[model samples]
Target: MTQFSKNIVSVSLWITVVILFGSLCNGGKILVVPVEGSHWVNMDILIKALHGQGHSIDVIRTYNSWFVKENSTYYKSITIPNTKGMDEEFVDDMLFKMINYERGKSQLSAVQLYSYVFKAIHKTHEMICQLITNIFESAEILKTLKEKQYDLMLTDPSWGAGILLAHELKLPMVYNVRWTATGEGHFDVAPSPMSYIPITGSGNTDKMNFFQRVKNAFFYLLMDIQNSRFNLPLYQTFCDKYFHPPVSFYELLQGADIWLMRVDFVFEFPRPTMPNIIYIGGFQCKPAKALPHDLEDFMQGSGEHGVIIMSLGSFISALPDDFTEEIATAFARLPQKVIWRYTGKRPSTLGNNTLLVDWMPQTDLLGHPKTKVFVAHGGTNGVQEALYHGIPVVGIPFFFDQYDNLLRLQERGGAKILSISTLNKNTLHAAIQEVINEPSYRLSMQRLSHLHRDKPVKPLDNALFWIEFVMRHKGAAHLRTESYKLPWYSYYSVDVAVTLFAVVLIFTLSIFLTVRYMCVKCCSRKRKTE
Candidate 1:
């Protein structure tokens, strides 16, 4: 062939190859509306993973979010006006006060917390409505979403606004959350029997005694009542104001295509799960990256004694100074090195054996050979990571699911739980030593880690597949339980139970009346004979 012809042919071949590759990718446009704060970390993994598969992903999040990458991005970010605004100081303040409130005054009882939360629902609903209003008021933004023609929505249930957006846009949505699923919550798409599925914050276990079960049941009913009285009305009002021909929030929730729960059987007790609830636990976690030179050197320097990594995540990083000092004093007495993620004033009691930083690569440190144990606030992300790395924990849980997760870890024999309210240097030191000294803690963690890893497909891959599966099928409506369509009475079988009760009552009444008549007849016969 002539040289010019050869060059043209090669160019054509390259073009054909590129076209074929693009066709094979078969990417779709995906929209992700993450709940604010560090939750973006979990959203980041799925976003990047889907982006890697050549899908176009767009996110609507809080302004000045840490997840906002500057340039050369696989996804586009749209900042929306939120209650917290650009300054994160308020968030830190709230978390600090919350933790202190629980830790100082003792952890609030389930009823107290529920009542408090119930009272706060209206404010929360208003905040969420404001966030959604900001987006809806902008014709350009709504127009853009319409123009993009997104195939599916991956929503954070914590935010509570994404479902509304999905409904407004007439798109199928998948709910994802890190919170433990309490059956009493609005997202009761499946049956969570109060018998085994412990109440989210009741501090009850799967194996509950009679009194504990009673407490669990009370908490469960209390939440449902709270939701019906407070949350449902607020959501209905929001929907009515925004969307035409009002829809209840529960209706929107039940219409969800699937639920991607960040729960694992390794930490949670085996409970019946619905077809639509997918277990993508640890999807946020990745293979540990190489630690920074300073951290690496610090771990290596620990030698035989090893190191313990402590972090309360972004939300609770700013712990009270005095509170942290108590922890620091305990760390000082330990033979092992301690790396604590502290944003507060450096503790004066900090020991020579300890290192403090504003942030540390948690998973990386946990995965390190020189790392012995993790002392954390028992956040779900931290708990999952510790389990994944087979590192036992000294859990000082403060609030929410942390307490429940710590209880599960303790039951599993992979952790030692300490009450944050009563925390002192001595208790902290003792708990830390117990986890470290107990060989069973490490062994139990290793066994669970093995089970976690022994899955048919990697969690990340499984997550990615299910996400795309929803896109391909438009919506996984078939996967939804028939219970979603049933009324409350039918869903709980209250009607069936009542009918059975009535039947038994009628039968017993008939037998009693017949025996009474027989006795009367016998008496009458005896009197006539006399």
Candidate 2:
């Protein structure tokens, strides 16, 4: 072949090879440690999905600890130390103070009064500086986490403190918010009017009852009060530190490059949302074949009827003869077998059909065909799993975002709730029966489950792609805003502009008056001389 022809052929081959290589590198490496409950579980699954797609992953978590069940292979598990416990009260104080400060109101309460005392100890310290310090200091768990290198961060609000590490390292960050990002804390504080930036919703199509909606409103009010009083000042200071003299709420949230939502579009009906956010519904999990041997046997032993799975959550237990008795009494009349994730010793008498274990693979057990209903504490993790399997639930929400999630689920016509304070056999049985006999409820859950599982890409894949995207883009600068960089006044600049306008007006008026005085004096002098 001619040398020119050979060269063209080689160049063509090189171009084709590069295109092929680019197509092959579809998935990206990621490092994530959402060590906090269902949030972490979903995060871990996402990391694994990346690994499945032939991308490298490193996860940080606690190792085999009973409290967190912390261990991972696809990614290194970074266990953050809880030595200082946490400043929940301090956080709340900070939040409350920021709320009232924004309205330009006085009369300090709660920790504001305490902050005055605390401020005495650190007269040299600035609250905004302290808040930024908290973000960096939140990596208190990093002593254990530094063992691994991460390119990007995937965290939840509960794990928001973890974002401090990413901030300190100047890593690109994307947060997964499970509840309303902002709101009043009347019914529940986590999910509120402020949940979404544009302030619509996840578009779950599920609207709460009038009372539930009212409760949501109440949550936002409390949030407004607390955030306006506490977080706002720290936020404003953060803004001033970065943007220099001006900040807005919109700018504050826009600081993060991306925000993943724990909402299912199938559930949200019609709510506006911003471009940076994506809702990954039921990313918690999907059915995976049969249950483990013992669990499957236990389910079959339930006789003619299917079984009921009751779990308060990983944190709380079913121990104490008291709570056990409530379960026993509730199951007494049921013909179905009951398998409870028992934390305490066996009650003196568990019903003949009942089986109790310290813990069972919840998703595994729920996937069983014989599994009919879920008696859950209404945590986001458990809720997502149950919805994934199309299992109707009798919610007994304990705390956190559990109550709000349950309310939304019940409103959607799939789940029913019994108050934890008023829990008993009658209430339990009623909820169980409703979930079991209601075909429509089953249908609602199944339909939603399909949509949740029907994503263009698995949540894990999506997460991995973003993580790699951040690494490739060197931390998405386009996604970040200088809201936190500017001062409150400078952020708006309206005040600054108005003040400048007034100053110029006054200066011009003074110059005109002086010139007029000189002219009149000169004219009078000339007239007298003449």
Candidate 3:
């Protein structure tokens, strides 16, 4: 044969092998139900990554979704109509009320604050339940969803609507979870002791004193009450109305095939975890991309002083005008250039060194070497990115687990928390200065970055592998725990303890009676001889 013919044959053979391999790795379809705001941000990243792996993706979004776009190259969106779901207005109002309470501008007492928070959360969950009800009531949507035959249901369990849908569809479920319908995700699936695992809003660290433990337990019970009183009833009603035999929404949540937890031990304090729980903390983080020319020039201008970047994540467009002025004034005093993400009116105290923009490439800026300190609202995404880039933080927590997130970093000596009520020009300035001047803050954060990076596989890749593992194996039932199936008393071994106590009590009483009888007979015989 001619040399040209031989070359053609080899090339064709290689092409055929490649084609066959690609066919073998063809991706499965995924149905994603995601929460709005920052939760959507995290889920979007995972969806894009999954799409890159040749997976076909379908997203279930509300008609008025705040972030999830109706059209996307990566996924087909199923928009549910006639539902007043969570939107920008809802979030803004909640943040405003929270800020008012925190800054003592409102007449709300501490008890009122809890009441307001629970009420707000209850309203949000009520809206979600209504949305789910709309979906279930619509025969067309349910028919379409059922016809899709997705390999798995991936959802954020912060709302129980997704959990309910997954159950209705009878698909193996996976959670992209940090928060569940009740408090933290781990509390739903794992053995979370109140001694160390601090509840959200509790502000306690892993190491707690006696009073701190009491506070932690109180917070846990409070959250339990909140879940039972406000959240569970809405979902339970749905279960009762829809299913032949009503299913517990909490049980379905706990029985998920896998949990792609948004935190690793590097971010979280040491705690017991299950085999099906995979840590993918910092998965949304990536190496710094080249900044836009304007941003790059601004960063270079700082020289040795470096830059301080501030963002309150996606939800808050701007703080109250007075708060912004205080923050802007603090930024003005810093020798370091400031890039503040603010959409409110320009602060009167703003200095020449500060630049205010409506939006920012948060992860990219954090990854930059010139970025020394992150001034954030202590959202999980921002905190994890700061850790990934080895940047210290000066956390200005507003509400909803933000304080606790910063508390973890502060306990590890990487960040400082400033309450919104106490935040002012001087306090904010001092915190930024303290974090910048202290080498330990940067050093501690860098150490965490190293540990977070030292994992065998990248967090994103690990998440993808496990996701595909579930798809390939149909479900990860082998890795899931059956403990979730047990009733609360049985799981806690309260019944066994009660049984053992009863047996011991009966044995002791019998021995006492027998000894008393012998003593009585001996006494009678002695008396007769006398």
Candidate 2 lDDT: 0.60
* TM match of model 2 to true structure: 0.66
Candidate 2 residue 175 C-alpha distance from true site, Å? 1.6
* Best candidate according to lDDT: 3
Please identify which of the two predictions, 1 or 3, would achieve the higher lDDT against the true structure.
3
TM-score of 1: 0.87
The list of candidate 1 runs beyond 4 A from truth reads 1-20, 23-25, 64-72, 82-90, 98-122, 180-187, 496-530
Question: 231 in model 1: Cα distance from truth in Å?
Answer: 2.2
At residue 89, candidate 1 shows an lDDT of 65
The CA lDDT of each predicted structure is 0.78, 0.60, 0.91
Instruction: Pick the TM-score winner.
Output: 3
Give the Cα-based TM-score of candidate 3 against the true structure: 0.97
lDDT of 3 by residue, 36-128 (tens): 999999999999999888889999888888898999999999999988778777788878888998888988788887787788899999998
lDDT per residue (tens digit) for residues 57-174 in model 1: 8887665555455343778877775443323564564455456566655376645654555555456556666777778888988898889899999988765678888998888888
